[model samples]
Target chain A: MTTADARESTPSSKAPRTERGRKTLRKLLDAAAIEFGEKGFHEASITGITRRAGTALGSFYTYFDSKDEIFRALVDDLSGKVREAARDALQSELPALETERAALAGFLSFAREHKEIYRIIDECEFVDPQSFRHHYETTARRIHERLEEGMNRGELREGLGEAHAWAIMGMNVFLGLRYAVWSEEAAPEEVAELANSILRDGIAPRSSNKG
Target chain B: MTTADARESTPSSKAPRTERGRKTLRKLLDAAAIEFGEKGFHEASITGITRRAGTALGSFYTYFDSKDEIFRALVDDLSGKVREAARDALQSELPALETERAALAGFLSFAREHKEIYRIIDECEFVDPQSFRHHYETTARRIHERLEEGMNRGELREGLGEAHAWAIMGMNVFLGLRYAVWSEEAAPEEVAELANSILRDGIAPRSSNKG
Candidate 1:
């Protein structure tokens, strides 16, 4: 979770200089996520974030000028992590549909581990509308790119575009909310496969086969 | 919009008895939608709602005791309206897949007219967690019931269960947010068709000569 990439993604004007500085920044972002996620923007305070990070109050000011700056940076950080989770799942060259399944599975696992992601991202709609919109728009764009790749490979149907990507993203997001964050009623793979089947063949009944 | 059903759906203890009372209550809820939608729950005030409603302060207290009470009532009111929109579109009998398409089209149009629905419903997650959960769970349950009917009628594939319903619900919600609420870039029918295409044949390439 603590990576140099996380540090680089920080939007603070004063970028960390050394390795220790990067770690401190990472700690602050991680702590900010929890603080904002739990207490929300109105109630969350700078001291609360530093207390959670186990860093001195000065450490917070060194990287972020104010709470709003840190919150914005934390959103960017989480957005990057969401992309990374999908990227990590897409490392292997799988079929178009399997790529989607793997990406959803990665997302479900990530959501289960970091349940606060939903809260923080959701709060962005109120606290920082731009970041909130940017997160989904960016995510949908990434999905649209994958859809194009699938179409070129002749695996997916033609005419799939931005709308289709948004549909897929929506399905994955709600599935994660119900199965991963709310409760572990179904395995991540099972849920992922169920969604994948819909994309593969839909729910239309076969002429000769009966369930 | 002012109907007996609307009044019946109100959770407040003081239900409006006369037509005038009902109209006033409806005004308050409509005004509350705008207020909460723009300012959010925390920042939204009772006076703001009353002022927009063109009702006196005493009228607000007559129907709703506090800002929290009005907010809860507004969520219920919006949820009911959503159901009514779908129900209105479903007057005629159609195939299961077609039924879904009609319902989504209905939702898209409704969302276009009442853009504040998303903001109010999303804020419920923070202000009133139970109501937020209820809104989605209830919507998903309704979708699941429809899938069951489709399965029973041999119109849809068997093994389509709660997960499939959730998938469909998620698709419609996000489609509405992107196409309807954010901007009317695409026609409602077009957005609905893009989603229906997924439910009907999915994104997979079709084989030769398959209906």
Candidate 2:
């Protein structure tokens, strides 16, 4: 098909009910996420996304201005879910070590369940550079806040609260990229354990944070 | 031009034994890096790379196999230079802190100088997932070795050596992605400070560690 033909399929049917609109939008987004995840954003066509969703090309335009816009909406949707999952994961009354594990597990689980969304968000830099940074900074900030709460509760060590939080967040993201995106050999539990061991115990010799 | 045309232009020439070949390859890689960085692997084409490089189509294939191969070679080439630069940065009997800072600075400087490479490696999963992981793990292994050496010399904290090394490497990589790739406002030096703060003082509280 011509590029434009592939770019334009059928349009979404307009509905008066907000719920119907929401459902349509969700379907379109979900399809877009899968397509973007598989093909990369630039390679994905609007026609492909709509066809997958059983919608029209114009319908997608009704929801998003362009492929880039759809990609952004997808990232935002998934990021919100990840944030919520992280929050829920932190709700336990476990000690520092356990808390750390739970948080990592929470993130891993979120990544595992929403594989398409995960891929789309992780590779957002290719689709749109600015949005990637915005989302990354926002997520980092959320993780920092969580760690700050842990610090106040005497859960984390003193010297580098925010710094550690950032490092931990970075570790989690990289590890998730590995376990979720790259390899299927390492089970989620295994990945979580390795991450936890490295984070809580650290790489220092005989240096458990017995404090 | 077609996608194949876009990738073939810049990758054909051999490593410049002569100044002309050298200049041509340099120009081609530079141009390709920008295109690859902005458009990503799949979306970027041989024609685009060549056009930017101001080189011939046949010349592009002479230097590299395919676009995929060119990307792989690009990653390999960049990693070697980065490792060399990091090693050179530590050229001294300076105290632990100075050495660490110098090494970090050197790495950051290299990252700033090669922003396109940074984007390629970081966002490469979209193009070739396997190659990205392979390159990343290889780079991680090298960074680990450096940190291991530092620990042996008492240049860095002992214990959990590999883990700490990984964290440090992750820190540098993520920061580079943020400051150099995703971010427009944050300077590389400033990002380095954020990392430096972590190395000097870890995130866990001193009290917890002591205990």
Candidate 3:
């Protein structure tokens, strides 16, 4: 499915089941990401988000209780999507390296499609420490599970059980933030290549390893 | 000399010819680091910084045209200090590996003292593209230079050169942010140990590399 279609496919039975409700919800989320990402959490208001979404002020309360609730939902939803994408890539029949490449590619694709959402999530760590910690640790553990699976299957270099997994995940996030999200010129593919090369070989000289 | 003493001994003239001018500049920088580090560049205000430094609002303008300029000064100054610290450690009468270890230790010490400043620099890349690019490339080149020096002196494994430098720098920064800045429970020394071990020995199974 196209990215927009994928993003729009959210659970709706909890909210109004009408078509208008779904469209309003989608618009609200889009506008909220932009507003929240740009202005930060404390500065963002539900009224501003609703106005930007072109919905009536009262309509906002139908979907969310407060601006904080909207932000919480937005982050939780995006985090879920990112985890699902990573898990799916891991399950695919790519080699270990290719799987990693695809997983990063998937993440970069997600960031590209939802740049504002990614920024909101990235800044959330600083904006809301408790919530960000809960989300970050959970995501780290999930990524670690994937790495452990690769190690158990002898698909990746052995002895790199958990720490290495954390390192790789953290390193990728750092790179994505600096090069892909913040950078204007560098393409995702180039960043991927650089990261992949560093991951596989490390900074040590090949000859030094033999010595 | 103690860290404080060393900072004091560095002639105030090192920054500005006038002692009063230098002190004012230092207050602005100190205030900027705290405000920017805590609230980020966009969120930090000149008024807040001046208040924190106990300087008149007009005096703030006399030193800095805008908050961005203050931020730029802080970043440039921090970057220079980090580089100079690294260089000083490397030049000491230590072996290659020892030199590297010392440099890492110096970095950890700096991180401990200026945790907020480190966060500001890391987040600054998201604030302005040109500023980030200039700092990132200069830092990268400095790292490459250190690695080259170590390799030539037979301190590091051969053939990696600039690539190795980049990976080491990337890994260290990622680890520092994750273990040090993100969570205070992690001591710099402990993170340094884990990282140093990983650097000395690859994550691959020990048996596989028994050449």
State which candidate has the highest TM-score: 1
The RMSD of every model to the true structure, in order and in angstroms, is: 2.8, 7.4, 5.9
TM-score of 2: 0.75
C-alpha lDDT values of all predictions: 0.88, 0.66, 0.65
For model 2, give the TM-score of chain B: 0.76
- Off-target runs (Cα >4 Å) in candidate 1 are A1-8, A208-211, B1-12, B208-211
Clash pairs (backbone) in predicted model 3: none
Each candidate structure's TM-score, on Cα atoms with residue i matched to residue i, is 0.94, 0.75, 0.74
lDDT of 2 by residue, A128-147 (tens): 66667677777777667766
lDDT of 1 by residue, A94-154 (tens): 9998999999999998999999999899888888888888889989999999999999999
| Candidate 1: clashing pairs of residues | none
Better of 1 and 3 by TM-score: 1
Candidate 2 residue spans exceeding 4 A from truth: A1-21, A54-62, A94-98, A157-165, A197-201, A207-211, B1-24, B34-71, B93-103, B147-167, B180-201
Error in Å for residue B89 of model 3 = 4.1
Give the lowest summed-lDDT range of ten residues in model 2 chain A. Answer: A1-10
- Cα distance off (Å), candidate 3, residue B42: 7.1
